[model samples]
Target: MKTFYKYAAFAAASLAGLCACSSDDDAAETGSGLQAVAQPQIIVSDLTTSGFTLRWEAVDDAGSYVYTFDGGSETPTTDCRLEFNSLERQKEYVVAVKACPRDPAEYTESPFTYIHVLTDDLEQLPQPKITLGSAYASKTVISWTEVPEAELYEFSVDGGEAATTRNRTVILSKLDKGRTYSFSVRAMTSDATRFTNSEAAQLSFVTSDADVPPLVIAPTTIISDAVAFDIYASSDETYYYEILPATTFAKYSPEELMTAFQTYIVEYAKKQGISLQLAMASMLKSGTQSLQMTGLTPELSYVIFAFGMDLRGNITSNLSSTQFKTTADGYSAGPNYGGSDWFTQRFYISNAYLAMTGYGWTNSVWTHWKGDDVTDVRYRTLTTKLFNQVFPDPYDRQAVAAFLKDPNYGLQFNPALLSATVNSADGYNGLTEGVSAGTSYTLLTLATSSSGAETVCVNSVTTKTSTEAAAWFAAAA
Candidate 1:
């Protein structure tokens, strides 16, 4: 008969050359006093980035067992299972196990059977120290302390496309006084084995203050999937604009929207190391400058927001906006982001799993979650590749994706999921880093009870490009 003692692979990773216990090792009958014990079949369970549980078949004559990790010292255990904990992530380990007979004088110890596996990666890089070196109406200079292993620096201004430099100091020029500029710098290395891109060293600085500049931003062209707008600064001025669906525009009050936009401006400016005064002075036009947007859904109404900068480089209170509808009908309207009302319930689920009360993210998607409000439960975040593989159809919110509901299968496919799992119910707050611009990620709740089902709440965000995010995070904000 085929043995039912099955050990899961990484959802069954190919182990063509790896060794396993032979059929002779599975015999149940005990041999003579001089006979040797046989190796046991090993089963892996609860595998996580930092730890895993291992179990072995119990031999008829075995009273205890010995196990060792890598070249570490052997430990004795009477049970058929042993667990490894607090191990390093993304590293491989060798587990060797052998059985000891109930009567050691009568039976010889069994030969060791081993399993080799690599842990998952869910670690984050430390943030570097960045400061505002100098601030002027024309430009701002920012420098970050060197990271020990960093080979280069990547920084962005006003949430713009990231730029790389080997030098510690970067100059951001083009001055408009009044509004705040945000700068974000990160340390990076070519070697991913030891490090990842660091969390941004973020700082916000305001250029010198000056008088107000008159500016108006209005859409000049509106097509089915694209739109173009004109930023009328009178001469040349600094401002930011974003587009939003009409429904999203209604969820927040005017004050809330203002605060949100202001936050975006500062966060973005800090990345680039330039103030609006500087950006506008150089990037803005002598008269009106036109910016074009494409890849929008046709026939949908969008609100265009124009945020002004004061002499202090702060967001102005008197924001201006206009509404426009696309001219043609070609593309489909994608999901509207922000607010819980837009959350996609992917499956039928009972409150059997741990869930987060709320999650917040930066423009760069640096995310943190407060623990589940009700009871303590475990949860994990998935990579974009695995997350999309699980949900192929974006429109199918009423899904019956059973594989993900199975804890073993879910963890196998998303090996890194458990690396970020939170054990606490009400007091845990953790930040999951390694987010980049224009990327999508999924978060999942793990089932806690045997009788309960898991929940997959995906909040898909289609962020604008660096060019646009640098201008603003969201129009509704």
Candidate 2:
């Protein structure tokens, strides 16, 4: 039995090879004498919602027929018949059929016979309920409940091309910010031939708008040893406060600075004499004396803060930090100096006199200045940074005469500011030789201007070690 099967397989292979060669000869006769087969007559029947059957009359010498519906599967049938099932409902299709020769070597195919047919329509589908979801600055999400018998859904926006998805939710992106838009969705059957739309299900929504900030100004004037300035406001918006060295101020993130500023406003308002409401309102409005800040160091760079409030009470337009440098004697000249170096000279004597007023000249304080008042009667050495105000040359002597004549001229040397010490009994911590190595320093004094503003003065000086103190004083030797 095995030997017989083997012999049969050999014969089949040889016959196939011969048929291939004969077909090649027929192709060679293509311009010579080859004839075409006749087109077949097709009959359609057994039409159903899912599929249909097709039949064709047998042609002479034909071995099989090739049939297809709407360019679908090419079916081979020796009995001149074919059927297609599991198709879409309510859809039109064209069926085409052709005949092939019975001879194994024949390669020619007959011209196709075309016919039209329609699958039975199905019941109209029910529309799905569409809804709008999250809306952002430039995008939004849409969703719908799954519809019965739905294989897919069509989502559309602004009458644009539809996108098909099996998902119940879809995100629409690239929308214009702060603009209104419309979106809709519809359900379709498995074949997509039966579809229904819910016109009432359309949704309209607006995207969120971008943030825009308001204008604000920072502090610029220095009025005392502890630098003070007025912050102006325009409206009843809560203004935040921020203070940081100019060097590192820019490094702070916007959100971080905002948080810190809130803390500053709360803490600062706690120390004011007015009610919280008034303090906050004053900060929100400008030109009131309520916003004067003091107790800052001199010769330092600082960045001040201001910003507008939003309807939600959140910080907005938060990029409002103005940079300013405090006025220090010798470091910077103030309006009162009149370009006279006497202002600088007066700053030192006046500043030291006020700071040392209540404290007597003890061994420690005397040694710090490197001079004993009784022994070194004519002079004292003040070692400090240079704080020199530019002075008019001819009037330098006259400015000196004016400064000595003032009633408060010797007040710093007196202990008058404190009740424990009296100028009549304690006398004065007299004299000063001069500065050794000088730089700028802002001098805060007990003196007040005529308008009641604290007097802020600037001057430059040279600081000296006790070892170098002898060279500054006339009586040190």
TM-score, model 2 to reference: 0.24
- Model 1 worst lDDT run, 10 consecutive residues: 468-477
What is the RMSD of candidate 2? 34.2
lDDT, residue 209, model 2: 73
lDDT of 2 by residue, 130-160 (tens): 5444455433556564555567888788888
Query: Could you say which candidate leads in lDDT?
Result: 1
Q: RMSD for all candidates, in order, please.
A: 23.3, 34.2
Candidate 2: worst 10 consecutive residues by lDDT? 468-477
> Local distance difference test, per candidate?
0.53, 0.46
